[model samples]
Target chain A: MPYIKVQITRENVTSEQKLQIIQGATDLMVNILNKDPEATFVVIEEVDTDNWGVAGEQVTTLRKRQAEAKKLAEANKPK
Target chain B: MPYIKVQITRENVTSEQKLQIIQGATDLMVNILNKDPEATFVVIEEVDTDNWGVAGEQVTTLRKRQAEAKKLAEANKPK
Candidate 1:
């Protein structure tokens, strides 16, 4: 209920991927908090990176964070 | 700094008008709270109407609210 909807503009993701992310986000919210997806309302907008920024900073940081997190998760994977 | 960005899907507004709305929203924040527009990052995504909803309600309510407010203001116009 108190989540912020984020719109990302990038060339790497397709519309199907965006929809998957939205559904995945809703699942994360529900699984983590036992909330309904309908009440949780998820919206994802795909945009051009040049068109969006964060605190006067480019949203490249978001992608960077995701990449780093993935690397960390892979590194900690058990055999 | 704590504002939620809203993406609107409508047919009546141009991109320039959307930009104006973004600037106006930032102005409202600054004027009402004395905040810096730069610090108050604004992002506006133009969405398709079918892609947006509000609490299981269509976003047509938003446009209706605006129209009603405008009509009320016009009716109360001072001579």
Candidate 2:
């Protein structure tokens, strides 16, 4: 069982959305590796945005990195 | 990989204690299931005690339940 835990700053997501995210992540795992979602425990934890970081940088910076990567990928596409 | 996440209220524990807890839990898994710690990702999240619960009951009550169970078992022992 591959356990994936997500620490999210956004607390406003409904329980259904939370379950969907868990299932969606589990689905990705299952689709990629043929693992059973029932065998995988995916936990999504809601935490204060200020409490998490990555590579000694704030999470907002990480989000920005994703957005920048998407922009760069879009720019490089053949028109 | 079974990822076990622990959300604790006590925040002032030494980093050593934190690591020890992670290793201890991982050791239990390893001893029980012969799982590799490297492959079995166990993440322990430090959360406010007020934010966590079990079976619609607070974590403190859960601790009490464990203590009570131990006491009952002790009382029933042949020794």
Clashes of each: 1, 0
Q: List DockQ for all candidates.
A: 0.11, 0.05
lDDT of 1: 0.67
Give TM-scores for every candidate, taking all chains together and pairing residue i with residue i: 0.40, 0.38
Writing each residue's lDDT as its tens digit, candidate 2 over A5-41 gives 6667864766556556665777877899887655665
Model 2 chain B lowest lDDT segment of ten: B49-58
Query: What are the per-residue Cα lDDT tens digits for candidate 2 across B39-68?
Result: 877676764433333322334445778899
Best lDDT among the predictions, by candidate number: 2
In angstroms, how far off is A41's CA in candidate 1?
Answer: 4.0
Residue B67 error, candidate 1, Å: 20
Docking quality class, candidate 2:
incorrect
Looking at model 1 chain B, report the run of 10 residues with the lowest lDDT sum: B49-58
Chain B TM-score for the candidates in order: 0.53, 0.57
- The CAPRI classification for model 1 reads as incorrect
Cα-based lDDT at residue B54, candidate 1: 41
lDDT (Cα, tens digit) per residue for candidate 1, span A18-41: 555556776777788887656765
